[model samples]
Target chain A: MFQPEAGKTHLLNRMSIKIITYLSQAPASTDEICHTLAVKFQLTSDAAFLRNIDNTLHHFDALGLIKKVK
Target chain B: MTDKKEHKQAQIEQQLALKASEDSLSKNKRRRLLKGAVALPVIMTLHSGAALARTSNMIGDAPAVDAQVDMEGRLLCAHPDPTQPQIAGGPYDLGMMPSGHYEKQIDGNGPISLDNQAINCRAGGGVVISGVAYTSIMSRSGFNIM
Candidate 1:
């Protein structure tokens, strides 16, 4: 995916694709996204996995792909 | 009997091969998926100048907090747990020491001897500021204090 604001291109893997897809549908917190993705992908939803999702969300926020809700 | 032994050996070999293949495939697939998922910012920026400028200017201004007064009585409980009520004796103040100085005292306690290491809020020892007794929630030798 190409981010025009950052002038950078990203290779979206299956997990990232799922994250963006979920965010596109509705606004959700880190825990909400983690839980939803865990159930969808049959993942363990451990701390490390949750941290990965948080990092991805932060990256998207930096690129202006997603906005943090007040 | 010879034929029976040969049949059993073939069955065992086939099962081992099947298990090995399944393990290798699953391990490889999971490893690749997780690697790509966690390792982000994979590609190069098309416009380095713009990206660099944006990054450089991300933080417009940062107000200095060292000079600010910590009026919250946070000194009483450094890491307050919501479940536990605030330390008694309200209207706490930082006393004569400036906020920055007080913060430093709390942050760095040169070298806490083993005797001082046992002194903590739970142990009933506290610091007195402006004649108000406030239990320092953290331990002097604990990792929390830098």
Candidate 2:
């Protein structure tokens, strides 16, 4: 298992890469993604998780890795 | 058995690829059709459907915000969907925001009875005023004339 010794920004980038890979398969809403993440990572709090996913999506959108279906 | 599984996966992949292509085509067609449906001038003049109420370009004139001007041009006051989640203490609180509203041009190039005469639509034709994607040189953050 690869352990990340880097700080929050690096962790965020790695998480965003995972997000982009998942989204490459199909478009998903923030809620749907957070639920999946929470289940996979065993995290809690859907609403707060949504905010993090939303922010990451915003960055991905700016980078043109994904586009809003709507 | 492994070969059979690979073939099955290939078939599913083919189907997914076909579906994705169909979706992309449909979205493109819808966007093109929507472009044609709205009046070209309205499309050009106003870009911000909601944030357009703040027309800082007009010197003394209050921005004309009917927000919901009917393309059918009917005089109907469209009340935004009540169930739609709104920004609390914002436009929703005022009951002034529309679900969607076209931005109106702030001024014309004619000598009008307004305090600041610099901005007007009298001389320009088809020159886009509203819905500008570029940052205004005269805006306050850059420059606020109004």
Candidate 3:
């Protein structure tokens, strides 16, 4: 079995919390999440930010936190 | 008595050979007839009828059928009715018949007018936005105008 790095888990946990909070209110697209993360979290529109969001979402999916309906 | 048995066996072998030759000739004749143009259309017609019967049987055994049109006047996915509409919104809105609905908005083309106001509809509970600019460069040009 492969395990995530300690730093990676910590970063994912923070992003997952924010995403769950937003998604709980209403369903949003990936673009919507990106925009919200930029405005609320002050995350810049950089490759790192985008990659982090994507990886965190994938982790959440593996954990069954959210599902893709369409 | 041994000679009599051997004679009967020889007669049976000759008869079998003659029957086999007749069978082979009949098969050849049938093959020639099948290769002719007259036989082609007859065989094709029978095949078509058989295919139609098979398709009809399959359609009869299907669970259910339903259809709907999208915002672009195109047919969307097929699903059971009363479940959800395949597409809904704009000029296609027939008002709540247990079907889905789309919100209206200005498109990313031309000038914003009532006629140009495109509706966003949901197909089977998923939102569908039409005439929106995609991520491609050509679509980005259209988005820039918006």
> How do all models score by TM-score?
0.31, 0.27, 0.27
lDDT of 2: 0.40
Off by over 4 Å in 2: A1-12, B1-146
Model 1 alpha-carbon miss at residue B116, Å: 87
How far residue A56's Cα lies from its native spot in candidate 3, in Å, is: 0.4
Model 2 Cα lDDT, one tens digit per residue, B79-135: 223543333322221122222222232337642222221122212111112222113
Report how far off residue A18 is in candidate 1 (Å): 0.8
lDDT of 1 by residue, A13-57 (tens): 888877776766666777778888999999999999988987988
Better of 1 and 3 by DockQ: 1
**Candidate 1 Cα misplacement greater than 4 A, ranges:** B1-146
TM-score of 1: 0.31
In terms of TM-score, the best-performing candidate is 1
What tens-digit string does per-residue lDDT give for candidate 3 at A1-70?
0011111112235556567667656666666777788988787868888777777666665654555643
| Per-residue lDDT of B57 in model 3 | 6
Model 3, position A56: C-alpha lDDT score: 67
- True-structure lDDT of candidate 3: 0.40
DockQ per model, Cα: 0.04, 0.02, 0.01
Question: Model 3 chain A: which ten-residue window has the lowest total lDDT?
Answer: A1-10
Candidate 2 versus the native: TM-score?
0.27
